[model samples]
Target: MSITPQAQISAQDKSYSAKALVSIALAWAFDAMDFSILTFVLVDIMKDYGVPLTLAAAVSSATTFARLGGGFLGGLIGDSWGRKAGLVISIIWFTIFEFLTGFSIGFTLLFLVRILYGIGMGAMYANGTPMLMEMMPAKWRGFASGLMQSGFSFGYIFAAIIYRVWYGDLGWHAMFYIACIPALVVAIYIWAQVPESSRWRKEKSASKSHSVPVSHLFKDGNTWNTIHAALISLIAFGVTYPINIFYATLLKQHGHFSPAIVANTIIILNVAGIIGNILGGYLSDIIGRRAVLIISAIGTLACSFVFQSISTDWERNLFTFLIGLFSIGGVWAAIPTYIAEHFKTTVRSTGQGTTYHFGAAVGGAIIPLIVSGIAPSVGGLAHAMTYSVAITSILVIVLAVLWRESKGSVLE
Candidate 1:
């Protein structure tokens, strides 16, 4: 039987149940927790292994590379096995590795485990975003996307608080051990709760009747648009993630803030991000996605300069909160929903996952290498961030000019 458009949407509204959102949120929250758990504990890990800071950063880079690979593979798996099942398997895989991460003895072993964990993480985020996006009503897409993305902040805060409590004497191993708990719980929740993406399931059946799989997303007209979107995401993160990671260290080094104060500031940033994400999602739903992006890009660029210049903690906190708010609407929540708009349901997950994770790999891995490689000769972290943010801002303007609005337009 052919699926009516109304019936398809109605089915999605009912099937995407609160249980499903909760499952996706839990998985993503765990994903964020696992990610930040390591960041909080990285110093101890470095001290224990006697590795250089640059080398320690490589572990994160390796995981990012692994996640990219996982995202590509997860698209196929989501197409074949189903989004719900793919999510379950990915969470389980990541959980197992996280459990084992506590036992790792050296940088090599830790890097090896993280690379494996990245595969699962890559698939989870890739599949999770599209799954949640497709399952919701068009009107609520931005809201759902923002709420889902906010899980990262929730996880980061949870990890920070947990680390503070546990890391006092138990050290970094306890943090990794703690990481295993949430993923395990999410794996079970996803297996038992989340429903398969009805859209993907319908498309897969349609493709079987045709005997030819859908073409890869890169071959489409929106392909160029998708590329631009991916580049913007990469450039956005070139500042976002790295800034979150390095800012505390820089404050301690040059701003004369103590480590405790620096840690509190980092937590505040994550908390502010949670608020920003909700506002961004709500605004995109009320205004249009394009409007949200334009506003976000301008705000992020302005905030970057102000954030870099502030020396006092109160000034820094106020600016950081605004920066987090700008980021919430534009870069973080809008990108996945924007990518989802560019392709048909058949290729929606593929386009969204690939561009998002590839951007992540670039932002997480390449940008850091560029900054660090130049840091010795270029003076210091603050100056490097200033230059990077300036370049990224121009790229955002160029990308905005390249993209035509996709909101309220039908996807294939």
Candidate 2:
């Protein structure tokens, strides 16, 4: 029930509302679903592509490379033109390539398809947070941010459902085809329904169509701050990607979990995540972003230890639920809000998007490969996750302590 102390909206701007927030989040949901799809269906991809398990895992990370380029370009386009057009173009580009991914015949061909797919992923994610951050009123920015971040969890939840009903019978490729279609529809709908960002429009009018260079982010007072923030995202990716991206595969192959059990667990975890996202953001509005982040980091650290110590399936499930709560919901709830508060409107989208996505690309693309390589040497996937999570949790705590608190700050 906490609120930001003051709400900032333009005196003449009358079009801002929650509907715009929902539309942006809807676009992002597809990105989350696509990312999660690799986790659930990697085995199928390996079998179909005639590649080894390492290559299969590498493909999961492959999109990250393409995304680096996509994020930069999308941010440039969004900042230069408009958030809406950038998103629509990004969605369409990803949708077509993702559909093409289903038809890839060989490992190289599939990898190439996925690289293109990453572009769309990068573009939308780059644009999504800042667009929402700019449009929503200050009082609700935290909650709005939480909802935007949880768009991925919601997408992950649906992917779990899809795996249950359609994945087994229709197969993974069919799932990709089906998932890509919704993205296209969402793109068209976003094009028709969502308004241009009111903040961006107002600024453009005031400046008479001047453009800001992306390189200027490096020259600002936030130069190091941006790097440190991006490092936080990188560490987030390092901890979460290995454990989450391959969790279902671990359960099914090693832990002897039934597909139903895996699907149900995924659903419950993400549902809890959605709640954590909203609650954590609301709490951050009252307390401070750094405090909520520290709380989240400590919770995640506790979860990691509990995970390593526990052996029973029930206990693992309990810990998994908490991990979803703290790691996915808690940490993510404050990130967009925190990042938005750090930069001016002229460079907000570019600065925030580039740092976040660059970290994501490096972590997403590389960590899975490392995990796949180290899992054998480190005893197993579970052990590898334990160590990675432990290290990243400590880093998060350190960063949280160092990063300045931005509680209840209005967006530029």
Candidate 3:
């Protein structure tokens, strides 16, 4: 029997898909490293710069706040030029700022540099996620989304490892300097290996007009989706930052854990998160995106109570793993696929970027500042986080219930 031309093309496509996933996932991992490195060293920065916890926490807030604009600009670039261009530009932009972060002589300088770095971090997600989703086959998109999102865990784990091994010897500045090198390599790899999204190209060719105004997202029937998606994103980021940004501080200040213990615990959390990411993604494919999201939210809420009440070291570790699995891992895995499917290809990047980062601004930026400010009066970081998580998790459940499922929906 002779081989079919269709089969040959299918084989070629699978090969390209594999390459794209690897390349994009690598970039995501490095991006994670850069963003998260600050969390690990935040306490140290406070002592070194003679700043209060609230001021130091503001550094992270500034970065996340800037992500809102970066995400919007990145989506516009992706929509207007090409996904690949937006991605490459974002990678380069972040890498440069991350490296420059090493040179900051004061807290103000560090805060400003990080805000710039945050923009690049936001742009990377805006461009890379849509590109990956468009390249994947419908049946596999859930798993692929899960796998891509897991790069965040991988990056967190890498940052943990770097902090553990190098921080004592070389200090935090070296950590920022080291993170930029491999990220640049990933950018070059993406530039050379990853092709532009075929769906974006097709949409561009088929449309009568070249330019789609940003107003289109809020016009017609899209207004509700645009609003709902951003709301969900806001809740997601709001719930997540309380746990993620402050976990180390909680363990160190409240629990009085050693540096080694803190790093190891974080590693455990991220490992569980990685597993949750894959599980959530796979389950979303099997059940539905909405269902998985609801499950994650409910699970996170239950676990937060358990995590907060626990006393023993062993119990703390166990619940930490659970929090990572349910909250950090599962909820995020389904987000990219769910949100990207909300808009047509012509406006998909813009919709995904703007809505997602808008959430980050309120949830990620403002929430942390609130947490830091209220910690002393509220009982400390742990209690403030518990209250925040409970409220946000409830909101997520409400939002997830309201959202229509997008699993297996064909992209335009």
Candidate 4:
């Protein structure tokens, strides 16, 4: 077998060696698993709280909105303070809030719990992605970054297993409490295993403890570029997230699958997603970011439409798994690397967090509304997803054409 270009290039550097990457990846993976434990537990939550599915979805949507705020705060602080410190703090915050989520006696309490947890969860992609990028060697950055997110797919799979084992007995409250353990573990591991980004530390030493304002993300020549970039990311994320979270429920309700089967299917799809993130990110590093993205977008457009159309249990599981293979998995792997290459280091985390969260929140808010609204009129979830995916794919292509590669681009 021939050696890949990534392997050839990555052979020279060992900065983010196997152990470092694995530690980082594991922390992030658990973070994802902890955050999404709610998805598996949502049915339990709805039952316990006597809420509607839409309302539970709204709790997630509310978390998306809160993430926007958390991203801004975490980005600003992560830039000024240290990336590792920001992450450790955020993990602790999420842990506390997530544990609190179990104690929620009513909708108001649960909403508050999710909102607080969202604050920490929002900062995750912002800080974690950049921190991993800064620590790793450039030649291997794409793979490392993608691997970091691969944990998310694993985490989703883990959540499924956790639900499979526990959902019958321990209940959602216990699951949320268990979720808190991972957060604490990550926080402790971060304190022990990770170091402050050498790049950020150097900058901090040079700056002599001066604090930067949140507005700096848009100041200087960065304003319009940040806006356009964030908008594109927003569109991508807005379309992907809610759909992934709600997909099992969608199949259960519209397609009439058993809950156990739907959960099992989610695990399978998330497992496929792990491969997609790695494949997409690795390909982008080789083929040029734009080319890989266009392929992913086109694939997403097709698969999403196909996914929405299935009527039988097998068809639903197959199509949904494929959807994760293309859309949810592939898109996430490419996004952070794309953003990191665009802006300077000075504002990389901030810009990335702001733009990504902006996309996430927008997608969270709009897609559900659109999908739910059109589901009945359009005759089903599949048709609605087809229309939504088609439109989003076109827009992604348009945006991809407009945005150029930031490979080897200078950071401030």
Q: In model 2, where is the ten-residue run with the lowest total lDDT?
A: 5-14
By lDDT, the candidates rank as: 3, 2, 4, 1
Tens digits of per-residue lDDT, candidate 1, 1-412, equal 9999999967766765566677797788888788777766656667889986677777877887788888878766776677787788888888888888888998799999999999988888767877887777777777777778788877877887776677777877877887788778878867776778777777777675432233656575666866776786687667576665556556655676654666677677777778777777777888777677677767777877653565876778887777767663345766667777776666665566677778878887788667656766767777776667667766766676667666555545
For each candidate in the order shown, give its overall lDDT on alpha carbons: 0.73, 0.79, 0.88, 0.74
User: TM per model?
Assistant: 0.90, 0.93, 0.97, 0.90
Q: Best candidate per TM-score, number?
A: 3
Instruction: RMSD for all candidates, in order, please.
Output: 3.7, 3.8, 1.3, 4.3
247-317: candidate 2 lDDT, tens digit per residue: 77777767777789888878767887888888888888888788888898788888875445334767867
* Clashes by residue pair, model 1: none
Q: Provide the clash count, candidate 2.
A: 0
The worst-scoring run of ten residues by lDDT in candidate 3 lies at 304-313
Point out the higher-scoring one by TM-score: 2 or 4. 2
Off by over 4 Å in 4: 1-20, 309-314, 410-412
Off by over 4 Å in 2: 1-15, 305-311
